[model samples]
Target: MVKYLVVFEKTETGYSAYVPDLPGCIATGKTKNMTEKHIIEAIQFHIEGLIEEKIKIPISKTEADTFVFALK
Candidate 1:
């Protein structure tokens, strides 16, 4: 399985998502839940496009923010 980087951000209208690996492929939704769901579908489409186009690019990350989470 390929691990793609999924980025989600809180927006004024709700939230949006993007996959770093697939440039220019943007997806938005009215809520975070919907955004995530759409992102998955977007990723699938992106992968299919890459395969058909014979692209060999990989996803890279350069995070602007870091966070730590603790289990409660």
Candidate 2:
């Protein structure tokens, strides 16, 4: 199985998510958990559609990290 980096953002009403490797693949929900579920389903559907169309599936190359900073 292939893995893709997903970005989640907090919105005014709820949460939103998207797959960086797959453009146009996105999901939103009332809660983080719900958004996570929806995103998972969206990823699967996106891949399936690509496969059906015989399009090349993008490789997962995006990575993310967090760093803490202190103010003096």
Best by lDDT: 2
* TM-score attained by model 2: 0.96
Model 1 C-alpha lDDT versus the unseen true structure: 0.82
RMSD of 1: 4.6
Q: List the residue pairs that clash in candidate 1.
A: none
User: Mind giving the per-residue lDDT tens digits that candidate 2 earns over 1-72?
Assistant: 899999999999999999989999999999999999999999999999999999999999999999999999
Error of 1 at 26 (Å): 2.1
For candidate 1, lDDT tens digit of each residue in 10-51? Answer: 999988998776787678999999999999998888888988
TM-scores for all candidates: the values are: 0.75, 0.96
Which candidate gets the maximum TM-score versus the true structure? Answer: 2
